[model samples]
Target: MNKVIIDEDIVLKGEHLSIVFGGLKAVEDFNIEIKKGELVGLIGPNGAGKTTAFNLLTGVYKPTSGNIYLNGTNVSRLSPHKRVAKGIARTFQNIRLFKKLSVLDNVKIACNSNMKYSPLTAIFRLPNFWKEEKELDRKAKDILAVFGLNEVEEEYAVNLPYGKQRKLEIARAIATDPKIILLDEPAAGMNPTETEELMETIKIVKEKYDVSILLIEHDMKLVMGICERIIVLNYGKIIASGIPEEIQSNKTVITAYLGEEVE
Candidate 1:
């Protein structure tokens, strides 16, 4: 009956998080704490509730029971938009981009959420609105440049290679200026070469943007390489929580992946 004890320096903390869908429990007694500036991984087999947890955190689905806190503020009741304003943003496992929009415009659209200019002023083309728009354009461009996407800024997102499209998703998430980013399978469909490049890009994003990340990835190699800590889930609950090496050697994690060793 021993439970995993979390460290106290928690930036994003969830307590007894559970989600029940019509008498079926999708997530049960789930808990996690993401410390400031820490890059952590959430790993699990299919149906382990990794994506479900992300949905609860981002307000896509409300938890049936639990508390979600961000930077010491209770955020369980906040709407998705309000959560973004409170510094939480996430990218989906599937690529979701404005396919018709240029790369720069996609990034710019994310920035619009934080823009201070009033719509009335923008519609009227006021001097103040113009100034704010200029500032936002500059900031969006700077963020795109960090991801090495400035070169393709004017190109349509649908035309970019698969890897660049993934990068653009990350860039858009960052453009929201979130303190915590949830990346769900950032390297899902990439070749090894693309994954390697993406690994580097993820590291760069962490350092340059000064944001903590919670990654949900199935690629063991990528997860082991970049994550400072790893949380393994099975059957909608955490089975093992430790550093990469510890996770690699954990008996519970091994059994979860390989099934219990037959007697």
Candidate 2:
């Protein structure tokens, strides 16, 4: 039998997670846990089902078998938005932003769900509506300031540089007030400098927001540099898992993903 969640520190847990399509098992027997404020890396070769596992965790794909618990609650059946409301948020492999919207508006949209004013109040510009709107504006700008995007808050999201766009996606995700964040290839298509900047951004966010993070990335430097623990996946199963040094030295991980020591 799968163990019950006895540890209160575990923010997210996946129990024997498996997903299948047709005759293929995209992810199999996946079990993992992320504790509060921990940064974990999921690394794998192409088609190793890293993203599939993320999809299962984020409610994009319902698992064929298993359970997902968020802070001790069984959330396996929640919808994506419901999951977000329950403090699980995620960024996609491809940056998904409201491209035509201003950066502030993008972040504000995510914060809107937390607003309690009804449509009638909003349409009539009631006192409660203005109060919530003013609070959301402040909160959105505060999130923007954390990402150093406050000056560009009025700029359309599409007009920002590639790096800022990545940051904005994360900022929008943060606006949802998630307990844990799933980052899907946050550094994809970035130059080394941008990657380094992102590393700092992630570090700052973790410290500032105190949220657990699970990241999927092909970038060894970023993974090894920031992750407290690393999990290697191959053929839809975990091949190795440990701290960065141990993962770097593990023969299975080296053969499967790293191919050699990262540094």
Candidate 3:
């Protein structure tokens, strides 16, 4: 993987983002600024509101107070689909996919949103529909190849082993042509070997797609190994932020998650 040059251009910004549910504050005073091609990680123990932060940025939940800016435009109130149109795409922690669908079909569905054909054209199997379908098929195959998933294009998503399934989810996310992709717990439930493979895949994804990535992951080795910058969250708040080496020895981050600081 080529080394990522963290640029000064900010693509996504969340300023003072906070959300409250009844008496609980799921996230508070959250601020993150991501450069156009940087890969950042969000790490914390479970229920620390790491996913909640993702939700706020992706418009799954309106910030009770604060603002979200994408490419210098305020997108705090835009709908999720609108955000997707603005180059924000994400994969779920739970490995959400069309279980019965072939891997190629899964990616083509993402491409369909960009197709110019009308509903009537699609229903009638018109020329435009066929034209767009062919292009989408090629695009899907290309991205699948980028993720090393092309060989399994005809396989059902549910039939993929756990790690390949994660790769497929990311491929689907990138197929939407996002400028910034949010990945939620991409290393969840993987063994050591699989996690290592995933870390490399993420670097490849960044290079192939040329997109910024903000991920939520608990695997310390994966997070510390791959992320250019790491943000530590605890109880819905960011407690630490820095490069991996700094994070490795930070007392607060260690206390929050690792029980003790590393030597």
Candidate 4:
């Protein structure tokens, strides 16, 4: 039970967060803070409650206890859609895309969450609706170009390569224009080269958009290379949290990963 010093410039804060399903406790006494514009990593072995914690933060599931705050505002009561509108967006561990929709359209759909036009106006093709539609399309195209997916703008999402699909998912999330983005295993199924490219893309995205990132990655190399800070979870609770060098040498973290007490 080593105590790790947490910084105070937190943009997203979880206070005593916990979640339970029936009689099984998934996450307990979870507390973490993500600083503004910082790239942080959340890592642990499978079933460590990493994804469950993610669900609580993103409003996919209500917390059984504790609270979540974004920019000092209590957002625990907000719905998923409202959370997105309030500058929080997330990508799934499994890629979720509309297979029949083109890459451009998939990204466009993310932007539609905040669309200004009413359904009646859009259905009737009113002048204001048409104007807003055009603007949305233009913005979506711009986002695709930023991700180097403009070439495949017309290609169906299901037709893209696996790595490209991953990138497209990120592009779609970014299209929502959120201040904080949660990415679950962004480099899960990529080769070294593709992972390297994704690392660069992530860095560029954070710098250019000024967005804070919370990443869950099992790839040690990728996590150590990209994340400024790392939090390690085990058995539904945080065991260690620190910078890369500190985490590498931490006794509790080493034991958690290696399955034996560190001397």
Candidate 5:
């Protein structure tokens, strides 16, 4: 992939990104650019390489070929935590939380990279350690409030309901103070009411945090309702991309989902 100058408005860009696992090409030539504060959706039939593409972007899996740029810097080789520090944050398709930790602690942990106190200060509980801890506590609670999780801030994460657990995971990602967030199927397993609530929550997150979002969701209603633009993938490649209305009418996308050729 040739290097291209990134626009200031582009928070994240992936260029000709491809990944091969063993003998299989999971994702090939996937390219995307997410603008500041934009909400974009990625949709495809199962096993269409959506998650693989996300992994490549978030540094969970390094691309076999191509480059990932944050702002204008090449971050294709950065580790997952390094990527997070550099303004990329992601949540898994499955909820991965510290089951035993309180909801507040879970969010505070994501903010660890931002803490300035030295290890010695923390080990001895110095004045600066308490000062930073107090600030993080206030910050975590504020984030939890956005998700309607403030009331449960002291509860263990494993005790929250399925929907609340999903919310908590998102809240934790936001705690990283990211430039962009990649959400993997945030609506999976949610009932209609929960899904609706989730849609609103996502909107609030974007507006309140000023963060760009790239969402992977199977729920067409949620996608069409909130996403400004949509990208459709089939057989590990993007087949169509445009505004939601254009994607809804695309012949290639229709065929990919229904498994029948369209005239």
Candidate 6:
């Protein structure tokens, strides 16, 4: 929040990024630039390198070649944690919550990473430690409250309902206060109502934070409804990039994913 990525308009930019495993190229010549406060969607059929792209962007796997910039700084070589500090956060398709930890603790743990107090202060329970701890708790609760999860703050993460678990993971990601958030299949298992609620929550998140979001999801309705721009990928390469209406009308997208749009 305090520091700025050099380009105030664009939050994330990856140029000609590619990654390979064994003899296969998981992603090839992938490129994208996301503007601040923009909600973009990355969509593809299974194995279209969509998740691989997210992993590379988030530093789970370094690219075989090419550069990635965050806020205008070249961060392709940075470690995952380093990139996180530079304002990149993500949630997985499979809910990656601290299963045993309380819902509130999951968020508190994220806030802990950016704490101002020293280890000695925390170890000794100094005044500064208590001050920071109280602030952290307050901030964590505030974040969960946004998702209507504060009521179950004391329950373990795994004990929550499936949809709530997904929401919690997203909330925890937001707790990191990153400038950009990558979501992988956020609507994977949600029923229609939950998916609808998630769409609304995401809209609220965009309005409240000065953040850009890029998500990879298979749910066409979710992607089409929430994304300002949709990037379509196939065989590890982009087939099209355009607005929701344009993408839906494209013949290639139709054959690859949608059977046929009925009148």
**Winner by TM-score:** 5
lDDT of 4 by residue, 6-41 (tens): 454667888899988887788999998898999999
Candidate 6 lDDT by residue in tens digits, 193-261 = 998998899889878877899989888877998999999988788889999999999999888775433
Per candidate, the number of residue pairs that clash is 0, 0, 0, 0, 0, 2
Q: Residue 50 of model 6: what lDDT?
A: 95
lDDT of each: 0.90, 0.92, 0.89, 0.89, 0.93, 0.89
In model 3, the Cα lDDT at residue 261 comes to 31
lDDT of 3 by residue, 116-223 (tens): 888999999999889888899999999999888988999999999999999999999988899999999888899889888888888988987899999888778778
Question: Per-candidate TM vs. native?
Answer: 0.94, 0.95, 0.93, 0.93, 0.97, 0.94
Q: TM-score of the candidate numbered 5?
A: 0.97
lDDT, candidate 2, residue 192? Answer: 94
Cα-based lDDT at residue 190, candidate 1: 95
Extract clashing residue pairs from model 2: none
Best by lDDT: 5
On TM-score, who's better, 1 or 5?
5
What is candidate 5's local distance difference test score?
0.93
C-alpha RMSD in Å of predicted model 5 compared with the true structure = 2.4
Output the worst ten-in-a-row residue range by lDDT, candidate 6: 254-263
CA deviation > 4 Å runs, candidate 1: 1-9, 260-263
